[model samples]
Target chain A: MTVNIISISQITSYLRELLENDVMLSDIWVLGEVSNLKRASSGHYYFTLKDDAAALDVAMWRTYTSRLTHNLQNGDAVLAHGRVSIYEPSGRLQFYVDMLQPAGVGLLHARFEELKQRLAAEGLFDESRKRPLPPLPHRIGIATSAQAAALRDILTVLARRYPLVEVVLSPCLVQGERAPDSISAALYRLYAQDVDLIILARGGGSIEDLWCFNEEIVARTVFASPVPVITGVGHETDTTIVDYVADVRAATPSAAAEQAVPDMAVLAEAVTVLRQQLDEAMSAQLWMHQNALHSATATLQRQNPALWLARSRQQVDDLVQRATRQVRYLTERRQLQLDGLRQQLITLSPYATLHRGYAVVQRTSDGGVVTAPAQVQRGERLRLTLRAGELAAVAAPPAPIEEQHTDD
Target chain B: MTETSTETYETLYTRLQETVAQLEVGNLPLAEALALYEQGVQLAAACQRLLDSAELRVQQLQSDQPDDQ
Candidate 1:
């Protein structure tokens, strides 16, 4: 074989290609103690990851560094994930880290804890910061994936519980690296729409799958929301940073929806109860007024002039009847008395003596009656009233009667 | 019966409650009480109508562009 001369640039390029082409080197995790860590002004991080037997140079660009939950320090054991490559300028092997976390613990868990502590210290998770939800929200904004099962569950619950509310869906990706920004954007859209309340929800997932909700951007977005937010992420066990910052936390998407709106059934029952109360109150009022009217009518009748006139007329009629009765009784008594007087007069009359055969005599000419024989006149005419018949006699007859009596 | 459509359910319900309360106070004139009763009945009917005819409306918000921040 002929010996070929290669320049330094050519050799470095060859080494870079060889290292980058390796499957294991392209994607890997390295557990080592950190040393010689420095953050440059460009916001990039330069560090050396070393083990007991070997050491490797590592580089984290600004994009990845800005996402770090905790800063790396010298002698800190860390697990870093990236691709291994050769730096052609210096002909050195380097690892480009996209993710870094404390060793021995789960990567996402470490980041989650770190973010939780920092945000908690900033008072973002304080109870005082939580807002009260509207008792009757007219419009509700939902931030979730359009195709997510969480969306379906939430809609189902909302429809069943409160069909009067208007639902505005601001769809976004619920998972992967760009999900945090997507969720933030969705929240912004809902805010501009002036929704009464917001529900941020996602279906059950693993920690890695639900990691976007735990991102700093998503957490900040939730904390900064103008209206109260209800968060339901993953299963009941999954607690994301957004959950801690939300006004209300629910176990599932359905629960979130349940918290966001009032139940129409309960409200309808309340309305019915109010209506019943209104009916009862109105009836009572009417009854009272009717009673008043009845009493007033009675009072009016009592004071009426027509009734007074009727009573006076009755009294006058009674008095007139008594006077007429008295007059008739007195007249009858007087008539009876007069009749008795007349009967007495008749009994005492001389006409009865005449009827009993005694007679009164008068002279034919002088008309003087002779009580005895000494006073007899010859011819006097006289009228007599008798019970039956009357007889006339002269004075001579009277003298003769006395002489006859003497002879007997 | 004379209620405007602009009134919300909450407003109508609240008015109904207030009317009932006033009627329950029991000191108003007959004409005033009758008027209140009429208003209360109308409010109740309106509330019931809303509950009966209400349907949920759902809408989607389309973002102007994909968020890359």
Candidate 2:
């Protein structure tokens, strides 16, 4: 029996036409890990999507490459939706990608990384632009589904942590197709009110389930929030785009609540400690002032001017007595010297000579003394001088002495 | 009662500051001084109550949220 053979080109052409025209194939979804990635100079990316057993060649054009946010590497798990075609030259089967979504965090993580890098380069996550959380939030607006465990956890924690904290709930779909829009709207509503803080919370889910939070709308909304927003989107291990953009990222809803309010016990202790310190400081300062006053009093007591004045007055009185004694001694010595001078004057007096029985002779004329005969001019001048007084007499010259010898 | 008690604690603190200064001035009579000292004890009790209230608040912030705890 003879068998008919078809041309290889014809078969390849027909398959290509079918794949290109078929809408279902045009929107095919394949799940695998990426291997053997090749990027061209034209900024297009070529790589193989694979798992443990099978692999498929994938291509993302320059436009899609530019839009990609994460890095692609070997062994990346991803769910790619695109049309299948044969490269005419290499004749290899390849999936030309239009829209690429990561399968798990592994594949999408690469895209996520790429997007993060690009956005980071644009400074979307700059530290300078990041805002600080309020010290104590008053009106807390919660953005999550009413049925979500995240909401319950947050509410319970808030109620217990700070019972008086006013909670304003704005319900929204946390996951699924409508989650992004719902979250965005919820944030808008919360912002419109005067809330101190807004918590965007959701329970843990798979990458796809939490994809809405990673949407551009949600990220922008979180970034543009006027009131500080805290994201408690999942468990501690899970990270979402919302977490990156939020003002604060908490490990869980309860933890977020814990962050929002100060612990009552710790605050109380701090207040008490401060009060004690204030007391000690004030007491120490007061004591210091009192001691200063005491020192001043002691100094004044020891050196009282009035006491010194009393002592000085005593010294003045003693000096006055000593001065009076010195004056009396000096006056007595002066009187003794005056009495000796009076005795000398008395010895020099003529009456004192008369008492010694001394007589003086003088001529009667002008009471001249007859010391020589020439001075006694005969009887013309003669006088006798006595210590007591003077008397008139005739001198007889030198013959008077001789005549007196004859009479004897 | 709680609210009034809290108010008393604040009033006591304020009065203690003033009265302690006045006593230190030493112009008051012996009787007046003894009376103020007794009042000081009451004010100290009020301050302790306020401190106790604050301790509860501090404990809440420092410890794990009850669910996690």
Candidate 3:
């Protein structure tokens, strides 16, 4: 065999090509414990992934490094996914890692738990810190990916339930490395908008795909949002840190929309009920006043002075007629009695003897019945009484009366 | 019947509720009660109009770009 002399560059170049071309090694995952992790000022990440039997050097460029959900540290068992390649100048083989995650327990999950605990301890996830959602929100702000199916679902649900709500969408990246910042910034934008409530929603996805809402920045932003925040991340089973911090949590993006708006049919039913109540109240009030007015009318009739005066006038007229009849009867009886007594007196009077042509002499000094001669005076003037008139005569009656009395 | 856009559905609903309460207390004069009833009816009609006239409106903020569907 002829020995071919090759320069070191040629050898390194050949090795680089050999490792770069292998389909399996080009994209592979290595499970190991991390060690000697370093971040350069250039934003590149250098780390070692090792197992008991072997070790691998890993280098992730700044662009991919910034996308890491969890920080890499020594002794963290991880699965690094990337291509295996050689640095020709250093003559060392390394893994150019694009993604790194904890193997036994996901690094992202561990970070999520750690953050959840920290925020919980800080009272960011306290139930008391949660705000009550508006019962009927007129304006709603949505922080989500504009192109996401979740957005479409939310819009559809809102339109179906209550279309009065005006939606302000603050679109952001809902996945990948830049998602956390993008979501946080979107929340800030929505916060400034004049909206009654906010819905931070995303469709169902794997934990890694939905990791942005699990970030501390997103959690804090949701907590500090001026308008109440309703979160619907991933699925019902996938609860995020922001969900704990948000004012309300829904099972799905459509559910978040339901929470943010009131149902029109239900509201209409309520209004109808209220209208009935108002009608009843108005009628009741009117009925009460009508009863009062009726009683007042009855009382006025009972106490009417005009009617009482007419009754009193009738009573006075009856009394006057009765008294006048009694007085007239009494006067007639007295006049009849007086006339009979006067006739009796005329029948018994001595004037009847004078009217029968019997003359009597009487003393003028005293008028006395000459029944007894002893009662007559010798020259006394006497008067004979008659019913019509009285006559005066001188009396020789003493001699005559004496003769008559002697005979009796 | 007035411009529905000027007032929010929430405000109109709240006012209607208050008017209902006032009517429910049942002590107002007939004229006042009638006036309140008229107002309540108007509010309910306005609310219905608002609900009937509303359309789902979606607006996108320009600061952040959304990803491809």
Candidate 4:
């Protein structure tokens, strides 16, 4: 009845309002196979939702497209939830997707598994290829977005745990289409550095946000890194392909930092233990040597040469005293005997007889005994001997004898 | 064992260990034993000094970059 010359815009605007006002169409769920999928450079997603029976047009703006967990492709069965709306200008009816999910099993998950199996079959995730991390790494290379909170967390933990480690930040994008190449480049850059280890890290995110780490190129690059790579790409629940290919896997960025370096407190404690061991070992050794020295000193004192010499000197002195006493006694005894003999001789001497008033005459010529007075010559000289003096007389020996007798 | 002050912590610790082992044998002559003991003491002291004086050091690498894949 409104065929009363109504314009096409008015009719389309009226239809758009009618379609938007329908509560069932305003918010609804549609099950279909995706077709004609296209991503505009402006980040919008355009596609057709179709089944064996019917078809529908779909459009997801950039904000909603960015939230998609899986990449849409032709003939992917999905459950799309959004509103039906009409464009007045083009007079087109379309479904604006707010949320999209795989119809039964997620196709992206299947692709992830597919890629994982293929890579695993190719030996990219071989355990034998994994390398041991350096015990004390001096240089640690980090591949992460500089603006990410994950980087801040890693830096904070590293500074707290091991400030001695040199940190080389190889910045890259952590998500979106360019993330794979950016991450691969960052890993390659780190591999060229003189680093002992590498840490590829990212904060927790949705599956799509974490998709870069699951990329085959990122995984292969991490697998081929010269230095051992440690991956901390998401929360504990998120596992990426790079995580499997890396030498080590950590649950969080802070955990990666923990694995990359040693704690200073622990090392300090080790040094302290070593010092204690040294002290105990040295003290025990010194005590052992001291005990040995004491025993040696005791043995030396037992055979002391000074003590032996002193004992020998005392023995020599005692022998000298005995010999001196024996010599003195013998000399005294002989002197006494000699003195007695001299007394006897003195008592029997002729001089003693003269003292007792006896006299004898002798020949002056030969001093023969004057027993025979007639043998004396008148001119011969004779001598009289006394204890104190000697006298000489000639020819008058008789008178001299008389005078000697009188004097005696 | 190095007696120079520039000895590293690892080197100093290793020498201190060796000195301790030598002293533990205890069969050297008196003068030699005393000298070794003195050296061991110094080594232990030097190890302590090395640990004490060492401060954590950090640096950044430069000059190498790879093309984006």
Candidate 5:
């Protein structure tokens, strides 16, 4: 018996379908460490899932990618569930991932937590300490390289949404060896220029590419900035130290720009609303004045000259009602304030301390109280604070009272 | 709106400075402090409105940009 030869494509295609259709392999689960995890612009994730023995190529399309909870990173131990299929074109078998979870706590997770705890104890992320970014900043200074896409994106957004924001680009290295120093100096320079706000931004990249933001120098720089600082370090999936120290953190460069300034459209809408409210209030006031004037005229027409004179006096008295009300209202308010001040003064007065029966022992050196027993030495001169008035005295040691008690 | 509730930026800064000054040397009278605090609250609200407006505006400004901001 003889077998006919097939083309290369035919064999691979047959093998592809055979492996793809294998019931057990069709829907499978894989446990491996992720390597070379790259998220492309299209939202597809391409990576290698490897164990000690072998590695399998894997691709996660955007649709299924959203379902995955854990962020994928190189060397992350993960469990992937997907359909095992062969790429017919490349004749290479790859996994189409549908789910992924971290295997216990990964190294990155541990490091992230450790850094978080250290920074938290150092009060870096304190909300009370977080300065609010200025709105309608006259000039927004950016600390990023002139050539970066982040700068372009920021400039483009500012020009489009808020032309009023005078942007000052403090161009500096966002990454690489000199990035940390450059970033810190750039911040100082912007601060010196009295920029209303500062933005530290960079496009997403590898851990090393974003290492500049993760540096101690960068974190300290962000922490000490007098001008509110915003950090746009990397993609949403990535977190860095600078992000923690920043007054506000943006997942991306453009977000940093958004976080740094106020929207013009919203401001316009607010102004419009205020204007409408003012108009309504003014109209209501006008209506009230018109009704008052009409009432007064009717009263005048109803009376003869002498009668009208009396009536006019009555109207004038009536007008005083408003003035009287205003005076009473102001007086009541002032009385309330004055009463409060008096009460406060009573509480703070030295006489109040006398009422509390707390006496101050003053030293002869000065009129100040001798608070500590050690402050006075035997045979030394001292003064006393009495409920009535200040009294001069000589410092004396306790007369053997403790010794007498001990003897008894 | 009441002027008390709509303090400007300078007034807010003045209130902050006053609070710091009051906090520094000695205690303020409780009643006087209550009034000051109420005024401080108005100042705080005004300041917060500014901050919130700034944040919201930034969000709006960058909402359509080519980055994840």
Candidate 6:
């Protein structure tokens, strides 16, 4: 063995290092009754945690003291969490507490944190795995204590929001040691009935009372449910593993029921809106057809035979008027030509030539004109003609040829 | 006794929605559109009837009862 000389500071420092480095002592929780509790002007807390066997000195820094949920008093059982270390100045073991809670609750909270981390690592609480609740659930299965006020609240909400849904309650123990198994069994029972949705609910209670909702068995059952689940366990502040695994988390049991189904009034209003849309759509379609028919009728009127006949009649009347005017002009031209021809005929008449001539002689017996004295016999008859009269005469002839020639 | 029908409110509502959508397209013939309008009116009435006549029914299972399915 080697002997070494050291001062008090050195020994205290060594002891502090040894105690601080010890894994089990560095971070731990100890349950004991609080004794000699004191608050200093620095906002630090000094107390002694004692049991039947022994006592330990505890100190909480000002930063941690503000986090204390409960005021410390003498003889109150508490679970204090901190590191055990040797105080260098006094070379004494002291618990430097950072957290203090009621004994059982503190222990339960530790287990809860551990389980939450383990389950979260397994992806049990993944948001992607969360199922969407049905917009209109036909049947909603409720898993809760039959005698619990949560059940009444859920029922009242369901009745008010959506009376169309059929509610099936699978009653179970919501507290105590057997509650975890009871809750899981209730979930299976609801599943067997083929519920469209499920509501897991419990009224507000102590952490111990609500411990079953935090149980692994209940969480697994909720995660495995065929339908989507809505969880409303404990109060708004009390969250559990089931809430993490459920599809929807509500603040209270009534809220869970509300989440399970849609309101009838809203559905009715939607139906009315849809009906109105249908009416408007149908009216628009009809109007379009009516307009099309109107245009078609107008087009048909333009092509009507009656209108074509009227146009043709007008054309015929115009032609008749032109034909009458042309006939009148031709008649007038023909009359004028006839009158001029008659006047020319009058100028060329033979009677006019006779009017200008002298008298002429003719033999009456033969109706021959005589020009010489020998043309008639000794007792021949002769006739004289003028322009307007005729005369008859007798002639004697006994002249010699020489004498007749001399007369010519 | 409750008047129970084979058609659910969801089914009727879905049909009503489809009918409205088809009508909104505005391409169907007059007779066809008229028939669809009549069908949509009936579907809407059926939905409203279901909603109006609804009553919440609550039942509890015996904890110790065996599965009787």
**Would you estimate the TM-scores of all the predictions?**
0.57, 0.50, 0.60, 0.53, 0.43, 0.71
Per-residue alpha-carbon lDDT of candidate 4 for residues A264-361, written as tens digits (9 for 90 to 100): 67766765665566566556766777898899999999799898899899999999999999999999999999999999999998889777656555
Runs with alpha carbons beyond 4 Å of true place in candidate 1: A1-105, A301-408, B1-6, B66-69
Stretches of model 4 off by over 4 angstroms after superposition: A1-76, A79-105, A306-408, B1-69
Docking class of 2: incorrect
Position B39, candidate 1: lDDT: 97
| lDDT tens per residue, model 6, A302-328 | 999999999999999999999999999
Q: Model 2, range A1-408, lDDT digits (tens) per residue?
A: 888888888788877887788888776767887778888999998998887787778888999878766776677667676788887666678899876655664456555665666666766566677677765555678887776688778777766655545577777777778778877887787787777888888888887787787777888898888988888877898887778788788988878888876554564454455445445544555566678789999999989989999999999999999999999999999999999999999999866876788666765657665567787666675556576676777666466877889999
- By lDDT, the best candidate is 6
Summarize candidate 3's per-residue lDDT along A1-408 as a digit string, tens digits: 999999999988899899999999997767888889898999998888889889888899998889887877889988777899898879899899987777854556557766998999999988887788888886789988888899999999999899887888888888999888888888898888888999999999988888888888898889889989999888889998889999999989988988888888998898888778878888888898899899999999989999999999999999999999999999999999999999999978877767787765445565446666677655566786654566876545445667899999
The list of candidate 3 runs beyond 4 A from truth reads A1-105, A310-408, B1-4, B64-69
Backbone clash count for every predicted candidate, in the order shown: 6, 24, 8, 1, 3, 0
Residue A141, candidate 4: how far off, in angstroms? 0.9
Between which residue pairs do clashes occur in model 4? A361-A370
Scored against the native two-chain complex, candidate 6 gets a DockQ of: 0.45
Q: Which scores greater on DockQ, model 3 or model 5?
A: 3
lDDT of each: 0.87, 0.70, 0.84, 0.79, 0.72, 0.87
Question: Deviation in angstroms for A238 in model 3?
Answer: 0.7
lDDT of 5 by residue, A311-369 (tens): 88999999899899999999999999999999999999887888777777777876666
Give lDDT: candidate 1, residue A349. 87
Return the number of clashes found in candidate 6.
0
**Interface RMSD list for the candidates:** 2.6, 10.4, 1.9, 4.4, 14.0, 3.2
Q: Quick one: ranking by DockQ, best first?
A: 6, 3, 1, 4, 2, 5
Query: Which docking band does candidate 5 fall into?
Result: incorrect
